[model samples]
Target chain A: MGEFDLIQRFFLEGQGRLAAGDEVPVGIGDDCAVINPTPGMQWLVSSDMLVEGRHFLSTVAPERLGHKALAVNLSDLAACGATPRAFTLALSLPRADEAFLAGFARGLFALAQAHGIALVGGDTTAGPLNICITVMGEVPRGQALLRSGAQLGDDIYVSGTTLGDARLALELFRGTVRLAGDAFESVRRAMELPQPRVALGQALRGLASSAIDVSDGLCGDLGHILARSGVGARLEADALPRSATLAAQDLALQRLCTLSGGDDYELVFTAPAARRVEVAAAAALAATPVTRIGRIEAEPGLRLFDAQGQVLPLALSSFDHFKS
Target chain B: MGEFDLIQRFFLEGQGRLAAGDEVPVGIGDDCAVINPTPGMQWLVSSDMLVEGRHFLSTVAPERLGHKALAVNLSDLAACGATPRAFTLALSLPRADEAFLAGFARGLFALAQAHGIALVGGDTTAGPLNICITVMGEVPRGQALLRSGAQLGDDIYVSGTTLGDARLALELFRGTVRLAGDAFESVRRAMELPQPRVALGQALRGLASSAIDVSDGLCGDLGHILARSGVGARLEADALPRSATLAAQDLALQRLCTLSGGDDYELVFTAPAARRVEVAAAAALAATPVTRIGRIEAEPGLRLFDAQGQVLPLALSSFDHFKS
Candidate 1:
């Protein structure tokens, strides 16, 4: 697709519902997307790299890859309680084919517009299929949520179900799933186009003392907050949210999947007990459920407990890029 | 060099002076850098990618590669007349080597701090050596310099010497130049650490009618301005800046070097005749020289002239990533 067509079909439409903005000052058509920052707001910026055969399977659909790339970065902004504003994409393609770019741009702009983000400036280069996206958002100063902000006795909450993608992957690997089938399609869609909790996150700005996006699995990513906040956490396994499909599998396997599976793109956050009601109301308004699964403690460690209150030691920690 | 040591050595030291109240809110130690955007200032965001064996040779020094990656994006901000604030880096490495990363981060942070920019947030992944940086700067609304703003009779100018990298690359390829020698060190430095005229660019906000950063050779990058501004340009070759070393080379080769060489990272901007004196003053204060190389014409085309005042027909255009 030509640049303008690609942008028109994907980006310029359906962007009004994401943020609190009306018209984008400079949208997808310009060399750069310009936005008027709300007064008293500081722009929060983050970038991510997604490479084929590393971040995703080579056979994965191009549209899914595009969606996930932007979704992952948007999750970062959500974790910080920043309202999405604009983003720039730098894409390196092995070859510039009209079909591939069309699909990719469609997937990207779908999510971007859903969040009211405009496509800004980016570089196109020739190389392997690698996408680097830098996203910008605005948050009130001293209010952007941080992992270091979790305090002891805060309630830990996570949005949506965990282990969804891992279960989908298992079914695909076992040859028991077909992407065309209704049940299988739902699973596949969940794995591919997982929505970030942007609205929930923004509403949690002051309520949630700390937050993180669960891209690298729940236990592992939660560990980051605990480490950064100099606190500990106790997660009750019974409180963890898992799909019925996941629960149907072996219990041990399901627990393992819930703890270690990556690519969830869900929001994990912490708030004081007093603000739990507000958080629940906000989640209801966003139409996404919030699950209270654990609590922050002053101790410096993480523990998982069984329904009977027995402590369970994890054989392996969460994902590490270098180690795993 | 372990990851920690490399980051500490290369990224943590020798940051330059900063303007008052311009400290980075969240710096290199966090998952992402946080900067307090000046109230009422719109953030200008841009990202660029530099791939190994594509944008530069494998033999190029790590330090230089680090600098160029950041410099190119800074050039984008400069094009918009934005003052540097903070940046995020996403780097993909074929292998994790402490020395390489140290040198790279060192080169990156040195330039960042020099411009009073903070390293905010980025991702590190495994792949071919690729560096993608997203830089954010602040500019007042409607005051950003854009390539689409050029008008007829606009005097086009370029800052600093051009063609140095191209000449230096040729010498290096021929084994006739060495970086170790003092005479060639300056040339090597020019090629490696191309300075983006950030201050001059910001100062040109009100004066410049249009602007662009010269990353992909003058002719190719200038073509972007022409296309966007709906105007043409007539460049006088004698006005193009050349290094003393390049001046000694074959005149035709020197001309070609300036015409097609990439990675200059200089500001090519247009200003009205009335603002020429102000532009010169801004250039002097920034410690960078400026030369009037061309003028914007009402017609839509590019023309080049030789030192003898003879019109030269361009046999070939500069680099085109898509067409090439």
Candidate 2:
């Protein structure tokens, strides 16, 4: 069978059992899928690309790749406070390995079903392995959180911990650092299946002054909110949350990973200090833990206070794909 | 500079003026762009992918490549009879080539402006050259022309011409065929920059029963409509229109190129014979010529007739990316 036939048999045909709704009037097998959105609602759209070498190692499992691919795009929606309605995947593969496609689709669909997202349509081709997903979501009018909404007194909050173990797993994989036993496996799972905080995003729709997903790093992504809002932030190094595995490491290593390590896919947001109780309640409602690590300031620069209560110069930079 | 910096300098920074209405509440520089669609319209979404070696050569102009990348996705919208709204580009490049990026963005935006499509959001990464665009458009409720709407007595029509000189250009590039002077340039243009039939699609919304854009050959793409509509087609060779450059070639080469050559981006549609005059008027209104060359039948197979009205064997297959 040709590529088209393989896609039809595996991806398109399988969508028949995905529980259709009124959202998609015309589904797959067409030039375009028609989305019938609720009246007066706003639609949010985003696209994210993951290359084989740049995004993950060549030896990574197809299932993990599939999960990561969709998860990353969902993270974008999470930051914007949009509930995903549907997604389209544009995949390029070196070959059509049925085993790999089956595993990949399983992982992708598992996460998709959890979040109630439907696969509407996409195109598959043969090339250097690459995965690109464009996810569409819906937000009530005037309720979508944006990076430009942060104010001077807004408290900066991060959901589900910072300094993800994904970077630690990368370090160990690259032989730069090593961990033992369950710690290594935990970090690996953190790296491979970073959960997208969709529910927490929906909960923060009206509360969050500004928000961004921590893909690159907490410091870097927060910098985006600061720059866009024309405000700065002061983060307490001692207050930054880290996993037990990350906390066990030395202080310097912990700070390095928390400040510069990326691939966390956590939500870093800001809200008014007075709404602190509401923010806590919202996180509790979504069952995703959150912590206040910093606060917005009028100045246009990022400042970090070390554990010793001494202000330290923010000299660290986020990972740059082009520089590497 | 980093990937984010390059994106800021080229894409996000240039989206300041897009004649924004209430449609786009937020453009680039965000995790997701918020789009507020017209309250009564249905949104159409489609994505297309192009890999370096499979879709184009290293010698292709960067500007043309950009145009083609977006044009192909727009063609999907055109086939659905949707008006272009916004698009997101996921580009993977071997390196950060500023000159190439500028030309590519120029070509892409040039066409986007003509169709009034705004660049909403996207991501760039380091990898082998790959371009995937997800375009969103809108159609009125219940007004979308789908492939399943074709009836047995419908007349099959194709917009513009077919066989597209793109195949001729491909053969010339591979040194399999030789063309001189204007023929080479004409075919090269067809290959490099085939315009998306957006206007033609809008015009055929109510006039045509079913429609599909020819990306794979007419024979294969027509098969998709036949499969979806649960009908078959009989195409007359004498009635099929080929470009002047293609018509001058030998009958065998003409048949092969016209029958199987892909990347035409033309609209192949079917309408009831009673709407023939209205269909012709609609094509004229869009300033795109269309020709009737086939008839839909209740049978479950495609039949082709030669110039002398004898049955022609069906040996042509669409381009399959996997096998190629």
Candidate 3:
């Protein structure tokens, strides 16, 4: 099929289509999609590109790939405490595969419908498989959660209690580790289908001093918050969250996984110690668990400590596309 | 270099840096760039993806590729009569080569500077070469041009006289045709460096009823307007604009190239016959040449007329990514 026909058949029908509201006057099928921004709201935009063999495995299901593609972009909005609004997808495929497109669209639209966000515009071309999505969202003017907002003496927290399952799944696929059949399925699911913490992020808007999604591991991502906010941090290594599967591993493996493992899509945020009660209430409102793991400090660099306060040597690395 | 370092080194420093104004308060460093909307305007968004080999040959220079990438997307915004604002780029490259990136960024930023659009946020990764850009612009509320606004008896117009020089260059590259050195360079430039008629599109805003960018050949792109507006058209084949070199070619070759040539980022629009004088004034004000080559019809299908007013057969095919 041709490019336009492919879009019409796979994307334009049965998707999570918002009505012609004041926010969006036009959707797809125009030169440019028109959005009438709401008064007093600022727009939030982010883009992410996923390539075959680098971002996903050759054997990954098309539906899961589709979900992950949009999910990652949504995670960026979640980090900034923005509400999901609309997105554009630019896809390149080896050929026009009907079955693959259908399965992919089903998974993509399913999540879009759940979030009430619409796919407004896109482009399709013939090439190696690649999915690039640009998501646009909204936050109240001057109210977005920013990485530069962190202040000294703030308590650092992470949502969704446990992390590192996705990294463990990657290790399993690489044959560096092994797991039981049921356990393997669980970790694999964590790697393939991550749920963006949109609700928790929005709930923490007025509470959290700073926030960032843990896509590149806690240790590395927290460094971003520190670098941007110009505050150091003291992380309790023993207090870092980990899944049951990860905790079952050796002490060294567990520490490495929890500290440096990436692709969790969990939000790592900070709040003033005085607002602990408010933070807990916000997390409760969103129905997402939160764990306090660190504290912002006036020092110039990150320091890791155990429960007994002994310094732990830093030898961890985060995922860097080019370096890795 | 890592992905983040690559972006910082190439994109962040000295590239069309728009100040943190009321429109764009946050840019690249944040998880999601924030844009505060102008109260009286609405946003126009469009995305385009270019893959190596499919969109451009490997022999082409990186600078031209970068220029073409943004130029195509800007053309879409131009068709909607939107003023340029900001854009996000999602790029995947096989490796982070600093030299290639420097040249590409130079070309990209030069054009971006000319249009006064900032690169707000984006992503980079390791994979086959692919560039996807999402552009956001703005127009007065309810005043942007659209394909669905055309009416019967409207005069069809195209900005920039030449249409098929890009295709001529492609044919020359494939050894299907040949030209003198100077002539070849001119056509090749047309293929590599398409200038989007942004000014003309904005000028035609209230005068033109409908507009579209001629990227997928005049026949096919114009077909979009006809389909969306529920009107037909009669295009004067002999009156179609052509470069001096193209005009010297055989009649059949000229007809095929002009009607079916793609990659010409010119604006094709329709305005009422009564607006001809104003249309000319608009084009003159924008400093771009335009040609009136057709008229919208009440019939349900497009027709082509020769210089003698005889009906011409439809034997041309436009570019389709997959089918081609």
Q: What is the C-alpha lDDT profile of model 2 across B85-134, one tens digit per residue?
A: 99998888888888899889889999999999998888888888899999
Between candidates 1 and 2, the lDDT winner: 2
Candidate 1 docks at the CAPRI level of medium
Per-candidate TM-score, chain A: 0.86, 0.96, 0.95
Per-residue lDDT of candidate 1, residues B1-324 (tens digit): 345334433443223112223455555433344567777676677777888766777877787788888887888888778888777788887776777776876787678778877766677777777888888787887788887888899898988875546545645655754544654666667767788889888888789988887766788778878987999988886668988777766776567667656667788889998788899998987888989988989889888998787997664344332132
Worst ten in a row by lDDT for model 2 chain B: B315-324
Please give the interface root mean square deviation for model 2, in Å: 0.6
Q: In model 3, what lDDT does residue B302 have? A: 82
Expressed as tens digits, the lDDT of each residue in A235-271 for candidate 2 is 9877888999999997767876777688999999999
Higher-scoring candidate on DockQ, 1 or 3: 3
Model 2 residue B68 distance off true place after TM-score fit, in angstroms: 0.7
Reference contacts preserved by each model: 0.55, 0.94, 0.98
Worst 10 residues of 3 chain B by lDDT: B315-324
Lowest-lDDT window of 10 residues in candidate 1 chain B? B12-21
